[model samples]
Target: MNIEIVDIVNKINVILVEEFEVDEDVIEAGKNLKDTLDLDSLDYVDLVVIIESNFGVKLVESDFANVITFQDFYNLIERKILAKQQ
Candidate 1:
């Protein structure tokens, strides 16, 4: 499946808003996930599961480390999707 970054971002925003109860205004691309969204270790696990289920991409532990911002998360998902395509 060819996915656009904006679509991925939109889906992520929906997940955060619905699952985490995050306000849409605070979910900008540059905002820090932990600081802005209050994502803890358990939240990350849920996020991983969500991503895997929604995007059909399995994220590794190392992938979580670099995902500091919403944009970083988007990039990671995009990369994973591209890798899956290959």
Candidate 2:
């Protein structure tokens, strides 16, 4: 099956849980990573590394600053993948 954007979000959630010690139960679709997910600046940096390592894409500061919700993050990954595939 083809991977949907939700799949990307789920992968990011896993990375947050595994690499940053974030609890999975607390993450929700509409939840903001910085606000609802309890991610500090350091955790956000760690998340960038996790995103790059897992998705094989680089995370830029300008790219991340606009990511407020899980959907936003998923969309960012999707765009990166598409850009790379082209």
Candidate 3:
């Protein structure tokens, strides 16, 4: 279970790392998505869309705004995926 979680987190990290040209090794769960990454509004939307597509979850703008860290983002995806299966 932990491994699966890490795998998804890595996928998210890969997107951030590639888009922002940041080192993936430095990205931590608690890191602020906007502050540390210096991401702008457009990037955030792109990220939200990518995450939704990645997890097969539909993300509302309000919901995406509330999500902060990478881990929080993963938790949202996890919940949505679980809900779909139930």
Best by TM-score: 1
Candidate 1 residue pairs that clash: none
Query: What's the best-to-worst order under lDDT?
Result: 1, 2, 3
lDDT of each: 0.90, 0.80, 0.74
For each candidate in turn, the TM-score is 0.95, 0.84, 0.77
lDDT (0-100) at residue 49 of candidate 3? 78
lDDT (Cα) of model 2: 0.80
RMSD of 2: 2.0
For model 3, give the 10-residue run with minimal summed lDDT: 1-10
**In candidate 2, which residue pairs clash?**
none
Off by over 4 Å in 2: 1-3
For 1-86, candidate 1 gives per-residue lDDT tens digits of 68899999999899989999988999889988889988788998898999899999999899878888889999999999999999
Regions more than 4 Å wrong, model 1: none
lDDT of 3 by residue, 1-86 (tens): 22366777778788778767888867888877677777788877777777777777787777766668767777777777677667
TM-score for candidate 1, residues paired by index: 0.95
